[model samples]
Target: MNALRCLGLGLLALALPVHAEQLPRWEVGMGVGGVSMPDYRGSDETRNYLLPFPYVAYRLEWLKADRNGVRATLFDSDKAELNLSLGATPPVRSKNNVAREGMPDIKPMIEFGPSLDFNLWRNEADNTRLDLRLPLRAAIEARSNPRSAGWVFSPKLNIDFVGLGMPAGSKEGWNLGLVAGPMFADRRQNAYFYTVDEEYARADRPAYQARSGYAGMQFLTSLSRKFGKTWVGAYARYDNLHGAVFENSPLVKRSSYITYGFGVTWSFLQSSELVDVGDN
Candidate 1:
């Protein structure tokens, strides 16, 4: 649910990204788009959701907000930096998914914490770089109010190539990014997605307790380019749950799944001067 719900925005943010050449101090706008994605993490079902995307990202002296997630760069150097990671997940309704039929609906989950990033490799003249990122976030859910769920630690290796040559062998306009990593969650987070209680359990699904363990692995790639007032971004993601600790859960439907999306952002308003980076 967390991965699928945010995939759209994540992709769009890439599409509407701010490039180095057009480093506008700030940007503000909105757009309407759509994304087709699976119902949840382990479900085989699919649904299309229309998205009302709000555009907001501030590049400032101390903070930077973009598709990469909001952060206050407390420490920044050529190689390593530390900041906060803000992320969230959408809820899954039991009635909407077959495998979760009789179970209670899930509440929205939010994560916030810190991250340490290191520049594993950088070739600025070639416009390429590799980064290793480690982020630890506390998970929470808001049903009646915010309640702690558990925690997640995701470490990823990210590679980027900007304004570089493409498959056609031209460097006119293209930006590419690739990232992969494993996700780990505590027992509470696992229970939130895999546990089954006696009251709502069906004949096929018995009451069971879940334990803390590995969640899954994810790989994502994105490609983008800008054309005048419009920008296009395309992305694909894969999640492997075959080796996941909760694979035995009755509510778990598929062992693997793919989520992809395409989006476009139009820029009608922009600034050239160094404007104050507003709150995003």
Candidate 2:
């Protein structure tokens, strides 16, 4: 059932045109890469979960610019821009050790959330600048073999520095960023497979009815260069979670870990006409 939901969403994402106008204003992008989550505490030893993450986003510019819209655009300057964005992170897989004696099998997990972006500064002359973004997300995740599911709310802050200085036609450059935040999840999501009481709750791990919260922080940085109209970039991030519930949860015994990877990014749309030169 969970697999079907994931497949349906994946297909839906694919069915949509690479560049479609579902909303009044939007930009579309698709990326492929290798991702690894290593050093989660619950496991007997370090385990690396390799998977791919694909996503899409839609923005309503006119509405955002208006005070009556769901989100309002606060700042628009030649060197800076700020906007609110609602987005989602589809289901992805995670590898886990089942037998305790052998390697782990791949499992599935899903997440989605909303975010705000602030362009701190942009230098047309230098092409070097910085940007800040904050993403607040609420996610529901489930596992394949154990048949366990949970809900989590996370608020993450990211800072980016772009080294855009290069030859006029050069497509190569680098970007570095940092990510830090907190994640809170209910106990039902943290319960063990066998300990769940099915009679009380429809899902597993019903016995653990306590609300568990944790503060987790991660650092991410990336570097990339453009090829023709496409840009290739790679990034790495590390996470550390600390709190009573996180420390005691069986699912995440090791609260500190590192996730790092390399990927390619492509910008499908670029328009100088849409770019605003002054505050409206």
Candidate 3:
């Protein structure tokens, strides 16, 4: 499960935002970080991690592998873009969790689908940008004979600040991002995490079927900076499952929690050729 978490974090760390400037079209690096998070969204179990992640970035006209996650552009404009996005979820072992003891383990899952991003506002003088993002993805378990988990929809408002609160003549390029959103999922997706089978039910845990509507709400903040060949960054996310459809499920041990991590990366390779990312 930690390996799966590392993979997801690696993908995320590669998308660090940069100030508008000419930059290499590609970069490769490695990063080490520590993280503290729950076993799953609603699980009470907390785990700390010290892991290494590879960093990769690529910029292209129709395909961009940058701060927005890996994407294949289907439609593009100055104010809006429609693209395919990818995401992942770490697995949970039943044996390691008290609520899931004696129950089946959950597999790591990958998600991919289309996303529509709209630039709602921008302040060129302050270098601030705001966007509304809507993404719907299909989830699939990772393993031999992978199975479909279900679909998830998340709509969020994202804001970014570049070079904010920096000292005069500071060379460091700092980016701060804030995102908040509500999540929704189908019955099958909710069931994957919340369902309890009759055979696995105990005196304290009753068999229950999960039906989905609202999953939860989340707020996240990320800060990153680039210093010469090295980059450092951290992020924290707050998840609230209060009033969620699965709140009543026996597996939901906590209603709110925070996940956070920080990392440092040294870019070992980058393209000699520069691309005009000033307006990107």
Off by over 4 Å in 1: 5-9, 13-22, 166-172, 274-280
Instruction: Name the candidate, 2 or 3, with the larger lDDT value.
Output: 3
Q: What is the lDDT, from 0 to 100, of the residue 256 in candidate 1?
A: 85
Model 3: CA > 4 A from native: 1-19, 167-171, 278-280
Top model number, lDDT: 3
Between candidates 2 and 3, the TM-score winner = 3
Ranking by TM-score: 3, 1, 2
| Model 2, position 41: C-alpha lDDT score | 30
- Candidate number with the higher TM-score (1 or 2): 1
User: What's the residue-level lDDT of 12 in candidate 3?
Assistant: 50
Ranking by lDDT: 3, 1, 2
Model 1 deviation from native, Cα RMSD in Å = 3.8
Name the regions of candidate 2 deviating beyond 4 angstroms: 1-31, 38-96, 99-109, 117-132, 141-153, 164-172, 186-210, 265-280
Clashes of 1: 0
